[model samples]
Target: MNLLLARGANVSDQDGSGTPALHRATHARHKAMVSFLPENAANVEEKDEDSCTALTIAVKGKFEAGIKLLLSKGCPVNFSYKPRVSNTVSCT
Candidate 1:
């Protein structure tokens, strides 16, 4: 991942769902990647299509490490996301 980033990978690039690497790393419980992203200029404020931030994904999934990492980095806690789709939100 570092190699890709070093090669100019767009850290802020989003998928079809507007999910960036930060969101994916947080949701996957990848604390290191999560930390690396924002440090490398990935937007801490980027939200997915559901209006959920990395912090929101961490909290919803009960990913303790991801939560602590994000919070310590000054991510917002007052977000209130409302998903546009009816897909089930995975909490694990």
Candidate 2:
């Protein structure tokens, strides 16, 4: 990924489902990659097709290191997954 970044890969580019590198890293439980992406400019606030943020995925997966890393990078602790509902989930 370092090489990819050096080669100008977009850190924030999203897949078809809008899942970014940060989200994928968190989902995979790769704490180091999770840390690396944010440092490289991946947005922790980005959401996938399911309206899932990296922090949300981290919390759901119980990935402690990932959750801390995202929160430290300033990812929002509260966001609404369901439209017009509420900030139903709290990553913090």
Candidate 3:
């Protein structure tokens, strides 16, 4: 995966379920994989079938390291839910 990323793999590409590499990494708790992705992987902000971003999933899945990485990479911490609740407030 690191080699592929180095060769310019599309880190932002979504899977059939609209899950981005970041999302999968977070779900799998693959901290190294999460770190190996482009530093901007969190910034892609791809939404899954449930309209959840990697940051969102990371928080929900208790992937604290991934969440921290995402935030450090500038992923929007203030992302809001469709129902209008604030993600930052609720996720914490």
Candidate 4:
């Protein structure tokens, strides 16, 4: 990953679902990758197709380490998500 970043890969690039590598790493529970991506400029607030951020994903997945890392990096504590409903739910 370092080598790719050094070669100028876009750290913020997203897939068709608007899921960035950072979110994928978090979903997969890759602690080292999760920690490393942020340092390389990954956006912690980036949301996926479901409007879920990496922090939310981590929390939903019950990944304590991932949640801690995101929080420590200053990922917003009040992220908002509106599922298919008309109401917005807050993930803290």
Candidate 5:
């Protein structure tokens, strides 16, 4: 990765689907890869084609270590791609 970076590759470069390097790292359960990412890895926060952030995948995958690593790197806990909707209906 260092060589790639030196060759002008962006550490935050996402795939055509916007899945960043950190997302792949989490999926592969690569602890070392997590550390290698910039300290501000969370800044990428680019969602995949499914609109799922790395944090969301880590949480759902039950990758406790990866989740903690992302959190420590500044990933927001309450990040959501879509706004929440209230169940209450308006009274006419």
Candidate 6:
């Protein structure tokens, strides 16, 4: 990843589903990658096709560390998985 970054890779690039590298790393539970991506300017709020943010993915995946890391990096805590849906899930 460092090499790719050094070569000018876009950390914010998204996949076919509009999932950014940060979202993938969090979903895959790759702690190192998760920690690395955001520091390099990966959009913490980038959502997938389902409108699931990195924080939402971390919560669904039950990744405590990932959740904390994302929160520490300024991920909005009040963000809902789907707007207008009263069913909100908690990461804590």
- Which of the two, 5 or 6, has more lDDT? 6
Worst 10 residues of 2 by lDDT: 83-92
Lowest summed lDDT across 10 adjacent residues in model 3 is found at 83-92
Per-residue lDDT value at 83 in model 2: 30
* CA lDDT, every model vs. true structure: 0.81, 0.80, 0.70, 0.82, 0.68, 0.81
Rate residue 5 of model 3 by lDDT. Answer: 66
lDDT of 2 by residue, 1-92 (tens): 89998898998988776778788888899988888888987887787776778988887778999888999999997864333346344332
Residue-level lDDT of model 3, residues 6-86, one tens digit each, is: 798887777886778877888898987777664645444566767677778777767889888777666666665343354
Residue-by-residue lDDT tens digits, candidate 1, 27-59: 889888988888888888777886778998887
Error of 3 at 59 (Å): 0.9
lDDT of 4: 0.82
> Model 4, 63: alpha-carbon shift in Å?
0.4
Report lDDT (Cα) of residue 63, candidate 1: 93
Query: Taking the candidates one at a time, how many backbone clashes does each contain?
Result: 0, 0, 0, 0, 0, 0
Choose 2 or 4, whichever is better by lDDT.
4
TM-score, candidate 2, is 0.79
lDDT by residue (38-86, candidate 5, tens digit) is 4634353566666666677677667899888878777666654342365
Instruction: List TM-scores for all candidates, in order.
Output: 0.82, 0.79, 0.69, 0.81, 0.70, 0.81
lDDT (C-alpha) at residue 88 in model 1: 37
Scanning candidate 4 in windows of ten residues, the lowest lDDT window is: 83-92
Tens digits of per-residue lDDT for model 4 on 1-92?
88888799988888876789999999899999889888878888877776678988887678999999999887886765444365443443
What TM-score would candidate 4 get against the native?
0.81
**Model 2 has how many clashing residue pairs?**
0
Lowest lDDT block of 10, candidate 5: 83-92
